[model samples]
Target: MADYNRWMNERLYDAAATLPEAALFEDRGAFFGSLFATLGHIVAADLIWLNRFVQLPALAELRGPLSALPAPTGLRDRVADSLPMLRERRVQTDVVICDMVRRLEPVHFDEVVRYGNTAGASQAKRFGPLLQHFFNHQTHHRGQASTLLFQAGVDVGVTDLNALIPHEA
Candidate 1:
């Protein structure tokens, strides 16, 4: 899933690069109102979740560059003010996510994580489900981004997960 997330992100950014700066930042009625903003939200959320993940006692010893990174000030805050900056940050964040996932042990999956939401509400949930939400959140916003890209005349080709699946020999 981390590889798929990275693959789609690369494709999305490549397509977005073809767009004019104005079009990239233009409001297109997506949740965050623009492709740039939506992309920013994805990065912000990833950092938030990763920060939370690092806080887990079971995962503390595994902290590295990801934990050293600062958390976003808010859910909707722009981690990067421009497309190029956003793409750079996105690449770095994706690498961190891939590394974090690689380090996880099977036992980590069953452990519960406790964190506060953006609304300041406290919550506790199993680590496995939280990880699912982390990836799902990316896909959900990426869908909005895909729509925005299409409306702007860019098509991200072959988004199906099957594209990543290996065929039996």
Candidate 2:
């Protein structure tokens, strides 16, 4: 998992690094009219999930001037900041998940995880499902970014999880 994550993380940054500010902020018909907005959403979502696992400040609770990365230059710098945060969150949450997995003798994958939902309402869902949602959410948005990158002529290579894994020793 670590090696695979490391490889993908490196790829993400490499792809991000190649993009020009103009391309990064181009309105390619993404959710918010720009690739930069879509990338911001991805970073924000990662932070939200991290908050759920590690008791960090909720992304929703972050009230301040939102840094507008409306240009490819600004977007790339934001991506630079976001990649490390995503990596740190992944490592920290993975530790918590590993501990949870190890401690359970008869694991209840259906155990509920309570949190506030998107509409600002409190909610609960099975842990297994939520974890699945977290990774799936990441993949979904990353694909959006990848598509945008391709449209901008940046080749974001090999995103498949299978390719991320190491061969058996």
TM-score of each: 0.94, 0.64
Q: Count the backbone clashes (under 3 Å) in each candidate.
A: 0, 2
Candidate 2 minimal-lDDT segment of 10 residues: 63-72
lDDT of 1 by residue, 14-99 (tens): 99999999998888887798999998999999999988898777566546777555479588987887899899989989988888
True-structure Cα RMSD, model 2 = 7.8
Q: Pick the candidate with the highest TM-score.
A: 1
Query: CA lDDT of 42 in candidate 2?
Result: 51
CA shift of 3, model 1, Å: 0.4
lDDT of each: 0.88, 0.55
